[model samples]
Target: MPRPLENLRVVDFTHALAGPYATNVLAQLGAEVIKVESPHGDLFRAYGDDRELAKLGMGIPFVGSNAGKKSVSLDLKKEEAREIVRKLIAESDIVVENMRPGTIKRLGFSYEVCKELRPDIIYCSISGYGQEGPMRDYPAIDNVVQATSGMMMVSGSEEDPPIRVGVPAADTYTATMAALAILAATTQRARFGTGQFIDVAMMDASLIFMYGSTAQYAATGAEHKRTGNMGFSGQPTSGLFRCSDGHLVSLGVVQHNQWVTFCKAAKREDLLEDPRFNTIYDRIDNAPALVEIIEQLFLTKTGEEWERQLSLGGVPCGMIRTVSEAMELEQVKQRNLRVPLNIPGMPNADLGVLGTGFLFAEDGPAVDGPPPFLSENGEEILSMLGYSNQQIADFLASGILQPSKKPETAK
Candidate 1:
């Protein structure tokens, strides 16, 4: 069985979370991704707090997103090094860069330059704002984008300060969007025999992730309200509640029948006849009283017990578990969301990484190899591009290329 992107080559000039994550998805889908790094390395290679890992440029953050790819370090300031990039792009199917807008152009590998090298290339540029906008020149990272995209504003309660999401939501979502755009461009090129230049802005992608809220505001001129620990459905029945076992359970009793079913599950069906809590409108109007009664009812059982009871009784609900706890579940193990990952010089470590979200029936997404050390595959890549051994050695000797720095200690 062959993976979807098998034999396709990508010239990756991206680094950090968003760009590398996009290429990581392509690598999982079986593309031969050639990660072009500076003579130093990607900034993210030293991003994590682990001293040993960062020393070897194999930080957890870097390894998490860079598996199944080849690495080649070249200082593009040198004309010879830039020529090498041109040659690689000439033979590659796609080119991806996440440098601040115009930075790649200054390096002379803009889409126009890439088009001359490979006319049908799919060039994707991921940036903080966009290729051409008032704020295009401004730099941005996940936190900055989150704050600027109105995401933080909708996260916390009215009394609380805006809360930044725990994870890099903007970067994560933008990566997925970039991957989708690249694949769409690939399909379009196959049909029309033309290339595409895709510009993905983190701010734009962040807003798109909150499309429903934005759309509602656009349509009704009503701003979204932040309801802490409460579900977006706006029903009093749908929210988080603490149970007797000191665990929290999230309930999804949005519909009228679900509310009724929940009351029945708790053997409190008398609430259905209560005028103040009978209809959805009445429940909304009398939310304080209704929530107080429901909270007391949930306190009678453990979170797990309530989950099983409500779920079996046709109400959507689940216990809120920590990430580690959730990972321990049988369902998580069976889903194959997490795959074994082995990085160079870390053979004894028990490492696992996530693949793409979706799976195929056969030849599905998978990591073909471990994450590369800096310039780990430079010689091989150069050879594949028709460079002789002597030429590769010369490039290495002249500081045009940086050799990989594999860790000496195996653990």
Candidate 2:
């Protein structure tokens, strides 16, 4: 089965999380993504403390986000390497970069240069702020963007210190948004017969993700408060509760009907007649009392038991699960969210990575292969560009192209 973006060619000049993640999405959708890296390679290759994997040129962080793409290592500081990149841009349909505002332009491959090479190329630049802004040059990563976007303020309890989200929410969301913008630009180019330049800022993407709370704040001129483990509705029953087995279950009794159903399921139908818990407003007003009662009732059953009963009764609820446990779920397996790929040069031949979030009836998103070793495809890429054997060797010897080192065999 043919993939959606099989015909598209991408010259990916991205590194670290945000940029690489966006190109990964494009690669999963079947685009030919050529990931160009600097002489030292993407910093993410040495992000974590896995020295063993790093020695093998397969750091977990790098492998997780960079599968299904070819790697081409080039020292952009060298004129010869810059010429090779220009040649690549001339043949590609899209170019993506996530560097400081003026860095790419200084490298001589800015939007203007790419447009001159490929008139209909889609050029996307992801950054901390934007191309033209006061803070455009400010350095930022996921945690910094989270703090600046007020995301840290809205997480955890109001009394707790501001906490960064456990996952790299800013980077991940920015990548997702960048991919969406790139696709939109592709569509626009198809219709208008001209390419476009896209500017995606991590801070801007984080703010967009908080649109609901921002809208409320704008309309009421009041700030949204942090409510730990609770829904924005603030219903007494819509939060995490500890069960008898010491596990937690998250309940989301939003609608009036769901509240009534939850009461019946937990044998707390008496709550229906109580004046303080009768209406949504009353429940919100007397959430403390109602929560105390629900906590006692939940303590009577294990989290799994309550999950079964509540789901059977049509109340939205789920048991809190660890990452490993969540992945082991039968439903998740059925969705094929985790897939195995045989990555070359790695000890584990059948390692698994996540698949695309959605499925298609036919050929959909897929991991084409394991993440490439640094410049694993450099020779082949240059050859395809009409470079002769001697020229390719010269490029390698001059440090214009650095190929992956062969894995050492056991002594």
After superposition on all C-alphas, the RMSD of every candidate to the true structure, in Å, is: 1.6, 1.9
Whole-model lDDT per candidate:
0.90, 0.89
Highest TM-score among the candidates is held by which one?
1
Instruction: For residues 357-379, write the lDDT of model 2, one tens digit per residue.
Output: 89989888999988887888899
Q: Residues 136-205, candidate 1, lDDT per residue (tens digit)?
A: 9999999999999999988767788989999999999999999999999988998999999999999989
- Residue 80's lDDT in candidate 2: 97
State the lDDT at 399 in candidate 2.
Answer: 96
Residue pairs in collision within model 1: none
**TM-score of candidate 1 relative to the true fold:** 0.97
- Those runs of model 2 whose alpha carbons end farther than 4 Å from true positions after fitting are 406-411
